[model samples]
Target: MTDDSIYHVDGDLVPASEATVSVDDRGFRYGDAAFETMRAYGGTIFAWGDHLERLERTCEALSLAHGLDASDLRTRIDETLAANDLADASIRLSITRGVQPGKLTPQPEVDPTVVVYANPLPRGGLEGESVWDGPATVETVETRRVPDEALPAAAKTHNYLNGTLARAELEGDADEALMCDREGRLAEGATSNLWFVRDGEVHTPTTDGPVLPGITRRIVLELALEAGVPVREGRYEPADVLAADEAFLTNRTWELRPIATIDGHEIGGGPITARLSRLYDERVEHACYR
Candidate 1:
C-alpha cells in the first residue's frame, strides 16, 4: 500500500488514511459484518460470481440487508482498483450493519456501511510467482474450531477471535496454525483450508463441519476431478495428515501453498501438488489473462 492509496467507504472514494467508521458502528463494536478477500489478475477479479454468491450468503446469514445489488458493489471494487492504479492486487470488501443503538438486539431498519480496499501483489498466472516465500511451516494447536452449532461456520463474519487465538498459540514457531473440530477431527488453517495426498488420493476435511468453504478450495476440487485425480472429503485426524505423502493449504492469497512441515514432520509438495498448482495457474490465466 502507498501513502496515497485510495479506499471506498460507504459510497465515496477517500484516502486510505482518512477512511474511518463511526465508533458506535456495530461492525466495530460487535463484529457485525461480512467481508470477502479476493484477488484481481490483469485487472479482472477472479471467480467474481462465486465470491459475490458467498458474500450474499453471509449477509443473508447475518440478516443484515444492505440494499446494494451486485453491480453496485462491483463498481465500487473496480473504482477502488482503478483509483489505486493496481491491476494484480489483493482486494478486501466489507459490509457492516451500520451504526445502530447500543444493544444486543438489532432494529429492523438497516443502514449498511461498505468499504473496499486493495494492496498491490505480484502478478498471478502461469508466469507468476507465489506471494509466499516458499512452502509454509504449520503447527497443530490445541485451539479447536468453533462448532457450527455454536456459531454458523458458513457465515464469513467479522468475528475472527477463534482464528486469532489459534494463531496466537503458534507463538511464531510456525507460519500457520492448524485447528481441529470439537471431536478432534482436523478442521483447517487459521485462514486457509487444508489438503493432503495419500496413496494417490487427495483428501480434505468436509465443509459440513466447522471448515469455511473457501473459494480456492472449491476450485481446486473441481480442477482435481477434471484432471482425473481421486478426491475425498471426510473427517481426518492429525496423524492422517502427518502420514500423508504430501500436504498443502489453500486460500485466495496463498493459492496452493505446500506445507513444508506440520508438527515438525516433513510433508512437502509432491508431483500431485505440482500438477495442481500448474492447473490452478492455468485456470487463472484462462479466467483473467486470456
Candidate 2:
C-alpha cells in the first residue's frame, strides 16, 4: 500500500480523501471504539486467526455495534490491498460506536462505521539505536500503568490518553519504557508484551495480570514450548527480570526483540535468548509474506 491507498468506509471503496466520519460520533465524544493493527505477509497475515479472535474479543469487551463479521473484515483487507496493488502491508480495522446524533446516548440509526485502511511499513530500524540484530535498552518511566480497576487495560479501546502520555514520560531514560503497575510489578512495555529469559526458560506474566495478552506473546509461548524450552506463566518481578539472562519485548511488526538494559543496568543477551529467537525464526520462516 502507498500513501494513495484507498479506505474501505462502510461498504464502499473510496479514496482516502473521500472517506470521512461524522465529527460528533460517540467514538470521538466518549472514546468508544475498538480497533486492531494487523500485519500481513506473503499474501497471508501473521497470526491472522489469533488477530481475528482478538478483534472479536475486543468488540465483545467494548460492546461496539458490529456491522461486519471477521470474514467480511478479511475480505475488506484483501480488497484494500488489491486496490493499492501491494502484496504486503499493515491493515487497521476500526469499528466505532457508530455515527449517532445523541451525545448522551450512542444508539445509532444508520449502519455502524467500519473503516479499513492499509499503510506500507518497512522492515523498521530495529529498536531505537542498535544494529539490525543488536540489543536495545529499556527504562522504567515515571508514569504507572493503570491497573484493571480503573479501566480494563485488556480492551484495546480508544481510551489511550494515559498510555500516550506515559510514552512521553520515557523521553531520555532509554529507548523505550517498561511500565509497572501501581503495586510496582512489571506489567508490560508501553505498546508490547514482556518476556524474560532466565535459566534456559522463558517467563511471562499470566492472564490474571493486567497485560493485554498480545498475539505475538502467545506465539512466543508456543514457540518456546514446541522447541522444548521451558515456558512458564506467572508473575515475574522487576528484580527477576534484572537477574535474568536476557529480556525481550514481543509485538506484531518485529515479533521478538531483545532488550539490553532495564532501569539503567546493562543486560546480557544470553544463549537462551539467542536460541529462542533463532529457533522461532526457523520455525516460522516459512510464513514470511515476502
Candidate 3:
C-alpha cells in the first residue's frame, strides 16, 4: 500500500492513514468478524460471486446479519480499487458486528462495520508473473488445526490464532507451515491449501476435515476434472505428501504455487503441476482479461 492508498470504511472512502474503526468495535474487541481475500485482474474482481457467497456463509456462521446487499459491497470494492488506481490488485473485504454493550452476547439489532481495501499486484493472466518469488519451502509444524467440531472450518472468521501459532513454529526456517488435525492427518498450510500429485492423480486433504475450502482449491479441482485429470480429496498424512511425485499450495494470492521442499525433502513441481498452473492462468484470462 502507498501513502495515498484509499480504503472503504462503512460506506465511506477514506485515506488509509485516516481510516479508523472504533476501539470498542466487536471485531477489535473479540475477533468477531468475517472477511474474504480476493484478487482483481484487469480491473475486474475474479470470482466475485464465489467470494461473495463465501463471505455470506462466513457471516451466517457468525450469526451476523450485516444488512448490506451484495451490490453495496461490490461497489465499495470497485470504488476502493479505482481510488487506488489499481487494475491488478489484492483485495480484502471485512464485515464486523458493530459496537454494542461490552458483553460476550451480541445484540439482535446490528449496525455492522464494513471495510474494503486493496493493494496493487502484478496482472494475472496467461501473460502474468507469479506473486511468489518461487516455489515455497514448507515445514510440517507441531501445531494442530482446530477441529471442525470445535470451530467450523468453512467459516473464514477473524480468529486466526491457529494459523498464527502454526506459522510461528516455522521461526523463519521455511516459507510456510503445514498443519495437521488432532488425529495427525494433514489439514492445510497456515494460509494456503495443500496439494500433491502421485501416479498421475492429484490429491488434497478433504474439506470435511479441518481443512479450509479454499476458492482457488475449488477452481483447481474443477479445472483438473474438466481436463480429465484424476483428483482425490481425503484424509492424508504428512508421509503421503512427502512421498508424492509433485506438490503445490493454493490461495487467492499465490494462485497455485509449486512446493519446492517439505521439511527439507525435495518434492518440487512436475508436469501435472505445470499443466494445472497453465489452466489456472487461462481461467483468469477468460474471466477478467478477455
Candidate 4:
C-alpha cells in the first residue's frame, strides 16, 4: 500500500515519521504503556464510548496519567478519521510514561506520550460462521492465563509477555489459545474472551475475576440480553469447556466465532453462538458497514 497519509495524534495531523516517542519512555523501554484497538465504519467509530471507558479504566487501574478527558479523546479520534478519509478503519492508541532515558527508577508525574494510528480494517466476515470453516469454535490452550496477582489481567497494558508466552503454545494446532488463571479456571484467550453456550445460556469468565474486559464482549452481552438470551459470567474450567454444547471466542478483530474443538474433541460454538453471531452481524453491520 502507498505510504499512510499523515495520521492524527493528540491534535496535530502529522506524518508517520514525525509521530515519535522518546526512547527512554517507559512504554518503549519497559513496555510500560497501555493500548486499545478500535474500528470505525460509516464515518463513525463503533463503541467509541465503550472503548474510551475501557481505556480510562485501564489507566485508572494503573494509576497512569490520562492525557485527555474522554470528550477530548473522542473529538481527536473523529478528527483522525476525517484526516484519513475513512469510512472503515482500525485505530490503535498507546500511551507510555513520558521521555526519561535509561535508568531503572520509575517516574509517574510526567505527561503520557499518546500516539494514534489508523489503518484499513480487515475485510471481516473472513470467518464469522457461514463465511468460512465447518464450525466457528476451535480449540486452543497453553499454560493457564497469567494470574491477576502476577500482572493485572484486567488492564490492556503493554505488559503482555505472559499472553505472548501462552500463545506460543497455540502455534501448531488451535486457531487461538484459551489462557487460564494460575488456579486453572478459564481466563480468556491470548487475544479475546472465551464464551460457552450450554442449555441456551451464555457463559463467559468474569472480568473482575480474570481476563481483559473486551469492548466487544460487553457489547455482545448487551445485544444478547436485548435478544432475550441469558448471559452469565463466572469461573469456568477448561475441563468444563469440554462438556459444553458450543463454544466461541469474541474479539474486536474477530467479532463472534463458534468453536468446533477445545483441546481435541469437536466442541463447537453451539446454536447459541450462531444466533449470537448472526445478531452481532446484523447489529454491527449497520454501524460498521455503510
Predictions: Cα RMSD each: 0.9, 3.5, 0.9, 3.2
lDDT of predicted model 1: 0.95
lDDT of 3 by residue, 1-290 (tens): 45778999998999988999999999999989999999999999999999999999999989999899998899999999989989999999999998989999999889999999999899899999889899999999999999998889999998999999989999565889999999999999999999999999999999989888999999999999999999999999899999999999999999999999999999999999999999999999999998
Q: For residues 230-290, write the lDDT of model 2, one tens digit per residue.
A: 9888876789899987888877765667888887787757777777667655544456622
lDDT of 1 by residue, 54-156 (tens): 9999999889889999999999999999999999999999999999999978877899999999999999999887899989999999999999998888889
> Residue 43 of candidate 2: its Cα lDDT?
54
Q: What is the lDDT of candidate 4?
A: 0.74
For model 3, state the Cα shift of residue 263 in Å: 0.7
Superposed by TM-score, candidate 1 places the C-alpha of residue 145 at a distance from the truth, in angstroms, of 0.3
Which is the winner by TM-score between candidate 1 and candidate 4?
Answer: 1
Q: Identify the leading candidate in terms of lDDT.
A: 1
Residues 9-31, model 4: lDDT tens digits:
55677877777666777887888
TM-score for all models, in order of appearance? 0.98, 0.87, 0.98, 0.86
Counting only residues 3 or more apart in sequence or on different chains, how many pairs clash (N, Cα, C under 3 Å) in candidate 3?
0
Which run of 10 residues does model 1 get worst, by summed lDDT?
A: 166-175
What residue runs in model 1 are displaced by over 4 Å at the alpha carbon? none
